[model samples]
Target: MQTGEHPQLQQQLMVQNSSGSLSFNSNLSKEDEEMSRSALSNFRAKEEEIERKKMEVREKVQAQLGRVEEETKRLATIREELEGLADPMRKEVALVRKKIDAVNKELKPLGHTCQKKEKEYKDALEAFNDKNKEKVQLITKLMELVSESERLRLKKLEELSKNIDSLQ
Candidate 1:
């Protein structure tokens, strides 16, 4: 036996012409050939079964991949809608801020006008009070003049009466 020789060649050499081993006959009966054919058919059936199982697994993986793709598309669409909503919300916030500023702008002038009108009203009230005080003083002076004129007229009448009595 050489170190590098084929194992099948060595086995054949050992098996051939050995009286210690039982050798099979070259001519096989029909029953023996039928047994061989059944074994070959069983091996073919097992291979076909394995191939069918592999095809079923491949189809299942393809279905899972399709579902994953659909889910990914749905998520992407939802993300886009959220982005669109956010943009509008941001714009609405900006518009609200502008409206607040405009309201403040309008209120500032209203407050200033209210303060000016209040000051004008106070000035008018003070002028009216001063005119009323001057009117009261004028009325008091007219009354005093009238009383002095009446006293002079009564003194003249008494002098005339005394002259008449002396002459008589």
Candidate 2:
């Protein structure tokens, strides 16, 4: 007869109760126990599912961390090797520069010597040219003396021929 209570819902609950057919207090405890068992089972299944997901995530993270560690070690080794190789190359470059400096030092005196020799050769060439000019002048004078002697000899011969003709 209450305003909030529904007669149809109360009839449905009464038909579900089991014991004597007309009893108001029936076996509702068994139904409450079954509902509690069902709720507990559902909660346990959900907890198990959550635990499985957590384990899967943990495994993925561990694998990623291991990969990172391996890559870090590989990079470290490569860096060490590069540094090792660079050390010797650095020393070699320094040695080569030293050798080049030594060569430059050695060449400076040789360059000065070569320049002095070239100057001496030019002076010698100039002296030889002056001597050649004097020799050419002497040769010209000798040629003129030989020509005058030949002319005098021809005049003497002509005079002798004339004297002989007069005697005849």
Candidate 3:
């Protein structure tokens, strides 16, 4: 029977010797030799195919990594640009805040001054009203004195006229 047809030939395994050289342990017919050579060739072909696939997978991974790196750089640049955009506004906001604070500082004294002026105005108004009331009272008193003086003068003139007639 041919070695290819023999199940035993396919089952036999190649092994390493003490020195690590691969050697066949079993004595083989010529057919078995040919079968072993065929198996070796098949194994070598499979190994080459695996190496090629490994290289392809590695290249794909490297390409993905490169894309990730590029994206990372772009994101960093965008972040910087965003920060740059905010920087001007941040400075402007700070300046505006300072101006508002300054205005508020100025207004504080003005507010106090306004309150003081209002109090002064109220006091002055009260004084003016009191003076006006006093003037009215004085005018009333003057009118009463004038009325009394006029009554007394009329009575005296009548008495004088009667006395003159009697003397005549």
Candidate 4:
């Protein structure tokens, strides 16, 4: 009845004869053996079930890992192929950019030249306009002088005719 002692051991201790000799109880031993056998059988069955479940989970994890590795390899191959294809286009893009830069450099000087030519044309046009204004003024002055000379010549002709009549 003390704490921590097995029930079978307590029972065996109580079954001692008054002569203080230990008496063997075959019935109790057989019952204890049968209970031990039943407990051992249940434990073994549970252990086997746990082992089978562990194996099943391990197999599933391994299969998933294999598939993941295969997908990763496929993606890597695709990336490599895309990079390979892009290399030529990248070079072509660089070449086109260089050509555009060269054209722009050439156009810079042409733009300046065009601006210079346009300024020269404007200056020449201004000079031509000034000369045309001067010509118009000169033509007006010439016409006025011609009218005055004609009046003087007419007055002198009238005076000479009077002098000739007096001499006749």
Which should have the higher TM-score, number 1 or number 2? 2
* Tens digit of per-residue lDDT, candidate 2, span 30-141: 6544543454456568879999999999999999999999999999999999999999889989999999999999999999999999999999989999889998998888
- Point out the worst 10-residue segment of candidate 4 by lDDT: 1-10
**Per-candidate clashes, comma-separated:** 0, 0, 0, 0
Per residue, candidate 1 scores C-alpha lDDT tens digits across 1-168 of 333433443343346424455343455456544544554466568879999999999999999999999999999999999998899689889999999999999999999999999999999999999998998898888788777777777787788888888899
Against the true structure, candidate 2 has what lDDT?
Answer: 0.74
| Candidate 3 C-alpha lDDT tens digits along 37-90 | 787677678889999999999999999999999999999999999999999899
Ranking by TM-score: 3, 4, 2, 1
Model 4 segments beyond 4 Å from truth? 1-86, 158-168
**Top-lDDT structure, candidate number:** 3
- Cα miss at 61, model 4 (Å)? 15
lDDT measured at residue 73 in model 2 versus the true structure, 0 to 100: 100
Cα-based lDDT for every prediction: 0.75, 0.74, 0.83, 0.78
Q: Compared with the true structure, what per-residue lDDT tens digits does model 4 show for residues 16-36?
A: 533477555465566555554
User: Which ranges of candidate 3 are over 4 A from the true structure?
Assistant: 1-85
- How large an RMSD does model 2 have? 15.5
